[model samples]
Target: MKTLTAGRLLPVLGTLLAALLCALGPGAGSASAHAALTSTDPASGSVVPAAPRQVKLTFSEGVLLSADSVRVLDPQGRRVDESKPAHADGKSNTAVVGLAGGIADGTYTVAWQAVSADSHPVAGAFTFSIGAPSKTVAEVTTAEAGPVVDALYTTGRYAAYAGYLLLVGGCVFAGVCRSSRPVQRIAVGGWITLFAATSALLLLRGPYAGGKGLGSAFDLTLLGDVLATKPGAALLSRLLLLSAAAVFLAVLFGSYAREDGDRTRMERRDVAYGLAIGGTVVAVGLAATWAMAEHASAGLQSWLAMPVDVLHLLGVAVWLGGLAALLAALWSGEPVRRAEVQRFSRLAFASVCVLVATGLYQSWRQVGSWGALTGTEYGRWLLLKVALVAGMVVLASFSRRWTGRLTDGRPAPKKQAPAVRAVQAATGAAKAARPSRKDKDASPERAAQLARQREALEKAAGRRQRDADEGRSGLRRAVLAEAGVAVVLLAVTTLLTGTQPGRAETEQRQSAASGGARTTAPAASGPAETRIPYDTGGTNGRGTALIRIDPARSGNNSIDVSVTDPAGKAVDVPELEVSFTEKQKNIGPLRTALKRTSAGRWQATGFQLPMAGTWQLTLTVRTSDIDQITEIRNVKIN
Candidate 1:
């Protein structure tokens, strides 16, 4: 009977794993979710009896506020806000701005912009009313970084990624292959590219964040302002680390490379160890510059995500970057040592392991549900990246097979050496026949003939070398194909960084659905009750908030709120605030003042609801010092 061997099973398992991830990778995640507006005081499209003291905004993650982070405009497009936006109640994720006293309100517009913890800028506009909702001339300006600035910034980001891979990979290749000049040149090119790209990004950041044109990139004041923010600070820190990297590179290619052949083995070993440690520090530092400012520093498991992200980047640099160096060495007309190739193969295998483990964890973090993984654009992009990585793995396997053949002493075809000798003999004859410029007896026509013969001999030598490098150059061609796939992989990764994380998009979609209009039939003559589920994404954060409104019509209504754990047990929270808003006639975020009555319950007596319609109910719950969520739901009032 025929049976499946381990080799056959390996491919089957890999196919199954890919299928599983494509269908069920919701638990795999990314920390780079863009910040989402969770709840707002007064609620968008609501009307109030009087102008609010301030407009408050809450987000899913921390945001960096600027002078004009939140702006309130009157119906006539006049600024009515205090101009300085500050964190509400010392909360890093909340922004609040005071409105000018006694300002007449109609359909007032609120425009807000902030840089999220992941270093991406987000902006939005909404309308609310006081006294009555009316037509307003104040228009919401669509906030966006102009096309020219966006394209330039994105290009800079791509260059930065490429430069980092080249710089780190080239250095590693030099260490492993012991072929200094060509690989070192690759490293130097990487450093120059990275340095230039980083400088450009720093200048462009100010304009990018503020949605300004490219001309504003050079504004000194804007640059100063950018320097104060977390993202800007991260970029500045990267610049400093790059300076240290320069020193590291100089030592590696200069003093380290120039070590005398007469030196003792012990001395050489010690010097190599020191360089390894120093290079590691510089490499990890450079990786940290990105981790601190991007997705790793923001979302769930952030404490662990940052370090893992650094490792992920280091793995990519070592494998893809090293592959590039190896490719260059193969085609440089230099004899490549068998041991160097074997050592790099081992390192590449190890790097792939690290990448896989960390990548799965990150994927789980960025995507929390199957729906999110399959439904969002971010998810689609991630799948594409996975497919590309899989292709690379296939190509790598072919390369490994060729490497094994070389190591196992498989004899290459015997035609290579004779080809090399023939080319050398032809080149020698051409050189012997060429006459020096000082030989006045030689005619110009004879000299031209010799030069053409020399060119022909060089071309013949190249063709011969190409024919027998390793019996059709299997290893060389395989590595080349792998390098091509890696280039595409890196581009996808750069684009992924700019896309919104699937988890964030899912949350935003849910928020919009919850806040949408509800056309429920008028309630009977009794209390109207609703149970809304809330998850703050913290410890014991999943639960239901039970709300009941007594005598649910217009005028005064009594509200009672009770919180519960997922297991149906009462759970007490640090704080809870509820507000109601009516969108049709544009009335009320009539906030309720509640007093605690029990371990997980609160009641507000004789609160006014005024005229009744389909109203939005917003509930804010804080579970810990930093864990909180705002939920909005629609309710019908008689």
Candidate 2:
């Protein structure tokens, strides 16, 4: 049995050590921050007099760059960029890439991807014209990473969370309660899981950021390049910290256990203090790895946020992870002392307080306003997490109540008696029926005393067993329920890391509304078209209306409109309306007399524009009998 256990454990330890070493390097944190594209030089869809020397990009926050962070491609989808992309003017928030000298005077697409300050990858693509807009521009996908890589990376994140909780919480349980083989195994499992997950993340970062396939995870060149970036460095730091954690675990289950029985009070106290201090340092370092790389590292009041985030993570580990430990102990078929359960309850309550305070601050920073709480995807996930936490708290209350009734409403047993020992003793006595001459020569009084003592011990054991079974039943159920809810809560929390913060989403939408409202410069001989997206609060009510105005100049023009769903498939609607209003001069909102020309196309002829300026082109589309949405875009009438 010993050999089997050691054989099984060897592979796990090997995996943990190998992965941790592979990830050893400099840096701190994970991919938690989001970067937004704030502006671009020459601007998207703008016409410049001559070919520009370089394309410049400015982001909402600092970004980590790579050789191919920014790419410039011609209308034919061919690369036209020359040198590697670099920060403009040594500004971390700005990126500049040189364009090929004397490139064709046509539209060019710029695709960019960069690591945000918090380690998350951000990407986007846009088009600009040198002299004249091309007949057709290449469509560049701005997805941050491939779907497969994203799924795998996200799974790694979830596993990391689970492992951190188990490792931290299990240690706390052993220190606060009594140590057990089961808890030690749980902590070790956590360590191995965390190491594997971190290694997977470090390997996947290159492909994830570059939007490459799963096979790219093994590219050493790419891995080295990733290690140079903040995200890569953060992952490496986490791995190094895990090495320290391994030592802590060794001391926890090995040295600590060996000294438990024979150590003097003073010596035991000293060892405990050492364990406490060392454990604290290890826990804080691990928590800091996450705080320094994620949302807390780059957002508002980051100086304060990082520490608060660490506290929050520690609190979560204690409460949720401790719950796991408690459940294991309850179901371990051993009598759990009331004091231990009470101690954990108090510890959990304190952790809950810390979680509440930190969670509120994080929510305020990310959501900003109540409207955003319901408006954005991140906000909704946060709300769900909050709900799950509340449920867990309710379950915790039940556990606490059950704890108060532990030991069968009696004081804890001074020494828990094991029924197995009594059974072994009884079996030994039966086997010794034919005693040796020395045993037979013993006094009858001595034999009577031994029998009486054995009977008393057996009775005590039976009572303890009954008390334990009755007392822990309710507490076990409550803790199990809480643990179940905690799993779901952790999942939601992991998902939120990948989601855009509500505050960022709101700001991006406002920026788009103000800056990208107008169409590209009109071509010399073709119509000008502006696409407007709309979404009504109904089923299948979201789509885009592509409106084109022929001979888009002053005075008379012909208008055509077509609607397409999110899949880019044309769809017919119940009704469509087109109107134009020049806000500067308070010109008439000349409603176009549009008629259906095909399944999803509408056209109107001889619309009088009267003046040349930026006009608001309003479009209303009804996807269903009652579901309709209206959108307005700024269109040039010259």
In order, candidate lDDTs are 0.78, 0.75
TM per candidate: 0.76, 0.70
Off by over 4 Å in 2: 1-32, 259-262, 408-468, 518-638
Worst 10 residues of 1 by lDDT: 512-521
Question: For model 1, how does the per-residue alpha-carbon lDDT over 192-263 read when each residue is reduced to its tens digit?
Answer: 999999999999999999988988888999999989988788889888989988998898898779968888
- Assess the local accuracy of residue 439 in candidate 2 as a C-alpha lDDT between 0 and 100: 62
**Cα RMSD for candidate 2?**
15.4
Across residues 1-638, which tens digit of lDDT does each residue of candidate 2 receive? 00112234445335433432333222133222377676788776677989999999987778988788888888677888898989888999899998888788877778788888888877766667788866433545444566588789999999999999999999998998768887887788889999999999999999998778889899999999989877788789989999999998998888887756577889988888999999999899888988888888885678988999999999999888888888887776556788888888778877876887787777777767666678666778887887777666556666766777776243344443444445456555545543457765789986776667667665554544443444577778878888888889999999887777777665654444334444443423446799888898689888888999865654335688988889999888888999887665444466776867677888764354533458898888887878888888888765
- Model 1 spans with C-alpha error above 4 angstroms: 1-32, 407-413, 433-463, 517-638
Best by TM-score: 1
Model 1 backbone overlap count: 15
